[model samples]
Target: MNLPHDDKTCGWYAALPPPQPARRLSGSQRADYAVIGAGFAGLAAARRLAEHEPDARIVLVDAQRVGEGASGRNSGFVIDLPHKFALENPDAQFKQRLLRLNRTAIAQLQSLVDEHGIACQWSHAGKYQGAVGERGLAYLAHFEKLMAALGEPFHAVEGRELAKVLGTTHYSRAVFTSGCYLMQPAALVRGLARSLPENVELLENSAIQRVERDGLGGYVLHGADGQIHTPRLLLGTSIFTREFGYLHNRLLPVMTFASWTAPLNAAQCKRYSGTFDWGLTPADHAGTTVRMTQDRRIIIRNTYKHVPKYGRSVDDSTRESIRAEHRKAFLARFPDLADVPFTHTWGGVYAISRNFTNFFGQLEDGVFASACDNGVGAAWGTISGTLLADRAVGATSSLLDDIHAVTGMPSLNPPEPFLGIGVRTRIRLAAWNSRAEV
Candidate 1:
């Protein structure tokens, strides 16, 4: 099995204060239930399991620090609606089901932040989808029509009004929807880990190297320095789950890069005219995502690469090239801040399926998994993980049924060299088609 090897350069994690020392696993340990991967899904799964079986010992393990993985590296948009393009599902009932599930996930997160007083810059400021070129504008119009068909509320901003809202004349048009939330993702995930129930034990920096059957209907997980024995196991490892001998060619791992500027001084802030805290996603799927954080830093995220070997193939040259792309995007959007320097640049991998559906069910007897959030991991990943725990414990509800109804198994992907060629060609075409938006 391949171990996680993410670079410790995430801007979100870098912004927070230092964390307490991590507790590494050694020798051997036993647990009633063990979950591999401590991202949003794994954290929720372990917490839910502890709730259902208070007397049972539950273990959660991660290859790195909890907040430094993909969960914390996301763009931090907790969307309450389906993707604008995803509405083409042609099944209004299916869209509504997804909406309910996403909202439930947001509500659960809100409750946790309130109960724990976690200072993650949680804001209901909503989100904006912006367009720069005529092609992007056309796509934005279709999205507006879809929103109207669903009876969802949105406000259109354009001309000087749009410039005032985004502090950039680069965007020609935009639509603001009031159903999303934004936050510091690393802080949120770390807070979630700290507030877990007493019965659940979290071990960080402990990568599971291999998995094998114990001949007694149980599994043994081998780590660098120790091993774990559990009768039942749940995996929330996303694309990394393939290392455990599952999901073979059914998943595609794409790498995305992001960079953030240092906090603007008073003079620079005076020149900037937009709201202090705002996030804007591009109307085109291949364009960049921009955000003006509460702390006065600007962020630009763009560029995608298909990395089948996880991120192990992302070398220094690849990182430098991506950073250059980020710089160009930033200057195009905010030329006035040309003198501002970026404090950090990093890349993270997200998994997607060929058919754009998540995997959520038992892979085998006493083994279950939830993965492939397809880029909406913030909310979708949370609910999927929570419900997965319920399914493992023999619990059922309408929500669980809704999940099973909307989600389908990932379809098979083409064999190796062919898959690599096809994915790279598709990514290049997307970037070229949306060049103006970038």
Candidate 2:
């Protein structure tokens, strides 16, 4: 199947100044190591390879510019907590492992941000999982039990208390936890790409069209404008791993939508927001993840779609419908700020498995793959990419074992038509159940 590619961007990218011009490949090239996809995983992979082999020629390529794809399109939460979906069981040891890897990922990203002095609004205010009704609150309370069992630190807060952190008294209850960070998603990824070591060459507008083993023991990557042959190739293409026929039916390509409100005036801020900026995810899985940004805009993300394929942007009708849903969410939370228009709305793709697993291993000769973030890309991507590079360099760590144990190869998905119907129906039922939270 052909992997989809869309430039559908959110307001995060638009809020920033124009980015640096992209560098594209124009001719055939050869490298000692090549990492495909310059998102968090690809960026970390290239950096780690350079760290281990500073003199080695490492090439990093992406179809769009850095921060233009899903990496840049996320809500900017670098969370180390077990994501809501991670509550598969009461396995305390498993929870510890999940949190440990996430912590390592955060530490690695913080090191880069400090070393390179990247200004991406990197905040340590953490995040909250809040609910707006009894049902939603029950979800938060259930998650609280798991957190307590893991010895996690958190404080429960009601609507008025929660409003101080988020600036609106919309949520009925919440749990404030440590170990999460929020930032401008696009800005942070761009900064990471820009700070890459000098030994690594970053190429944009260079989507990998196909890959085949060259007769001379190298993999040939055919880009639109050029080709690259490398002794070692690391695939960090995420959902597009299907494009290379690696994770075919194992990975599902799905879409999610988000919109950003226009900047609020001082009076509006005084009336609507608190002194501090904060981010929060819904207590309900199908609900919304919202952020009261540092720059005074309210960003809300909700709703999911099953788009098994990519390459084309979503239609305007879809965008408008999501925008309407976003509007509804906005009004529910901040009816007083209903005038705050969603300046930009967009969608991004996520690769999911039946049991929320990721893929990390050798796909073919000289081909190492690390992808399927299971909806937690920022921290997961960083750690997976770093560890993948280690695997490629023959460097072993206990973390690798944990990765293999938890994120085993994805289970097979149901066949299409039925698959589509099943997924769509599940999402619809879940979303309907979470409608109050949304």
lDDT of each: 0.90, 0.86
In order of appearance, the predictions have TM-scores of: 0.98, 0.97
What range of 10 consecutive residues in model 1 has the weakest lDDT sum?
Answer: 1-10
TM-score: model 1 vs. ground truth: 0.98
Q: Residues 1-438, candidate 1, lDDT per residue (tens digit)? A: 556667777899999999999988789999999999999999999999999999999999999998899999988889998975567788888889899999999999999999999888888989999999998999899899888888889999898998887788999999999989999899999999999999999999999999899999999999989999999999999999888888977999998889999999998888887777889998898999998888888989999999877778699888888888899999898899889999888888888988898899899988999988898888988899999999999999999998998887889999978999999999999999999998
How big is the positional error of residue 138 in model 1, measured in Å on the Cα after superposition? 1.1
lDDT of 1: 0.90
- Candidate 2 differs from the real structure by a C-alpha RMSD in angstroms, to one decimal, of 1.4
| Model 1 per-residue lDDT at 186 | 93
Clashing pairs in 2: 4-310, 4-311, 5-310, 5-311
Put down candidate 2 lDDT per residue, 207-240, tens digits, no spaces.
Answer: 7889988998888999878999999999899989
Clashing pairs in 1: none
